[model samples]
Target: MPHPNFILLYVDNPQQSAKFYAPLLDKQPMESSPGFVMFALDSGMMLGLWSKHTVEPAAPKIPLGGSGELAFAVADAAAVKALYAEWQQRGLQILQQPVSMDFGFTFTAVDPDGHRLRVFAPYDPAL
Candidate 1:
């Protein structure tokens, strides 16, 4: 049986996307070619950034608008807040500031291409 693997996103500019994503991901790409770069996340999931102009004809097109909102389970609310501030300082568009929710503390931000990312940490009842 074939195992499920990486999810690749098409980007008009791979280098710029890589720069924006590297810090958020907390790691640099393990392998990078002219058309692609892949970062291995802590969850063992691989995120790939592929050059839109160079990808194969069969490569799936990323949906326009906010169809996909990637949620990451972070360590704590403080970490989430720090990342939110960092991304904002970098001039990235923030959709929401960190807030307590039923499930956790969360925030949202949009990448260079308007891809939405929701970062969150489990809510602590004591806090």
Candidate 2:
């Protein structure tokens, strides 16, 4: 069984991308280079930032979920709101305000590369 545990995002600038991501991920890159940086996420997933112009043989079509929206799961509604407020203060481009939906309270923000990062919590009717 093949397990996918890594995600790669091609950015125009790797260093800048790492800087933008560090605070959000609450961690720093485990490895870095002039053209690449790798972040070891707490969820046991690895995120790599690579220069779009320098990938070997060039990268095939990038999969960004219809608009580069990356959904990040949160602990709950409060966590979602806290993140929304935090990212809002950081001045990232906010695409949507936090609101209740089929999933739960959630919001969307845009990264430096125009990637839509969504934070969502699972809905539960029970208190």
Candidate 3:
């Protein structure tokens, strides 16, 4: 049976959002246009960033402050930490610092267009 394969995100500025997420995402978008961009994830899922103004007026809006945070599972905690530091240096707001949690180590940051993203690495199984 065919299953869900992609997640579409509406942003005020698709180009800026694409630039901001390129480094954080596993891979840059395979396709990008003036109003949209698509990134292929390692999990076989795809993410689409589309300009809000370009979407049809009939399209449903994603509720503000909804439970739609995007979380990425990384392979290395150090890499995630470095990325968080880099983003902070680039003037992005850091919502949470890298911290050890029950499930793993994670940090949260807001993208250029205000989307919340969490980057994390699983704890060492040998710990």
Provide TM-scores for the models: 0.79, 0.88, 0.77
lDDT of 3 by residue, 34-119 (tens): 99999988889899998888887635665653457788788888888887887788787888999998889999877766678888
The better candidate by TM-score, 1 or 2, is 2
Model 1, stretches more than 4 Å misplaced? 1-3, 58-66, 124-127
Task: Report RMSD for candidate 1.
Answer: 2.9
Top candidate on lDDT is 2
Error of 3 at 42 (Å): 3.6
Which residue ranges in model 2 land beyond 4 Å of their true spot? 60-66, 125-127
Estimate the overall C-alpha local distance difference test score of candidate 3: 0.82
The lowest-lDDT stretch of 10 consecutive residues in candidate 1 is: 58-67
Q: What is the C-alpha RMSD of each candidate to the true structure, in Å?
A: 2.9, 2.4, 2.7
Query: How many pairs of residues collide in each model?
Result: 0, 0, 0
lDDT ranking from best to worst? 2, 1, 3
Off by over 4 Å in 3: 57-65, 124-127
